[model samples]
Target: MIAILSDIHGNLPALEAVIADARTAGATAFVNLGDSLSGPLWPAETADLLMREGWPAIAGNHERQVLTHAIERMGASDRFASERLSAAQLAWLAAQPPVLALTDEIFLCHGSPRSDLEHLLHTVEAAGIRQATEAEIAERLGDTPAALTLCGHTHLPRTVTLADGRTIANPGSVGLQAFHDDHPLPYIVENGDPLARYALVRGTGVELRAVAYDHLGAAAKAAREGRADWAAALRTGLAG
Candidate 1:
């Protein structure tokens, strides 16, 4: 089985827990959908850990912003990550592609095939965040000849099967669980429980897994970094 992880956002405790869980589940390969080292907690340490493994990864919007844009061109979170990461870490982020065609049947991307910033499986309709229709997701995916596409950016566990039998899965976040974004749109995303999230995929089957961890410690780390918002999210998994 392959373990899929994303949006780690520098929380080392959560990442450690998720890795242990996936490993115990007999996952032999690890794929990290990026936005890995873009938070206040442990970007440097997390980067070092992941780099040692050299797991395959795709770049997320935060990774792109950190590598390609100046700190002045980034938002608060991106700026925070970029400012503290080592030069080698920045280079590693720069080396990742927006998409990875792992095999003829399997693919990996941070968000969508075309843009790492687009949510291929989600949309804001009315007042609620909803999963996109099969057609909508297929349209966003374009002509990628993949039966299973793995993506993460939303930090929500999701699985969508298109009419053509294409499956897309977001394993959720390994670190941060709840967050609010207001760049291209305004929305709040939450999981309501402080647990490390990851995914296991074998064949066409997908499992969204959550691993219990010491969330209070993660919250303390975020708080020490002066990110009270992140601290609250880490602790409660609720929107802060």
Candidate 2:
């Protein structure tokens, strides 16, 4: 079995709980879909753990932004992570690819195959956020020939099988559960509860799993860091 993780966003406690749970579930290997260490929680510590484990990982949009953008111009989450990460940690993030092929039949990407900042399974519309059509997903997938494509950017857990037998899955977020985004429009993604999330890939199926952790402590830590919005989201899995 393979354990799939994504969008950790620097909450080490949550990651730990998810790892333990994955082990108990008989996951023999692990793959990370990035957006790993950009948040107000434990950026450096999270980096340490992930780096030591040396799991097959990719770089999400936030990782690229944190590395390329001026620190002053970064958002709170990226800026906070940038300030806390050591030089080696920054280098580690820089080393990851925007997308990867785990095997001849399995592909991994933070978002779309074409763009780390784009959502592979979802789209932003004037009406609201919604799942992308098969055509749209196929377009974003481009010429990648992997039968199983794994992506995570919207922080939503989903598994979709294309008409051609290609499967795409998002395991959800391991840390932050809810977030508001404003790009072409404004929309929010929420899991409706505070829990650490991940996925188990077994045989030809995907299982979304949520594990309990010390979320209140994570909320208090975010509060102490002066991000009440993060604190609220960590507590309730709802944006403030």
- Tens digit of lDDT per residue, candidate 1, span 85-157? 8889888888898899998989999989988888878885547577788878988899988899999988999
Instruction: Indicate the residue-level lDDT of 40 in model 2.
Output: 87
TM per candidate comes to 0.96, 0.97
Tens digits of per-residue lDDT, candidate 2, 158-234, equal 88999989999999999999988997589888888899989998865889999999999999999999999899999
- Compare the candidates by TM-score and give the number of the best one: 2
List the pairs of residues colliding in candidate 2: none
Candidate 1 residue 177 C-alpha distance from true site, Å: 0.9
Top candidate (lDDT): 2
Per-model lDDT: 0.89, 0.92
Q: Give candidate 1's error at residue 140 in angstroms.
A: 0.6
Model 2 TM: 0.97
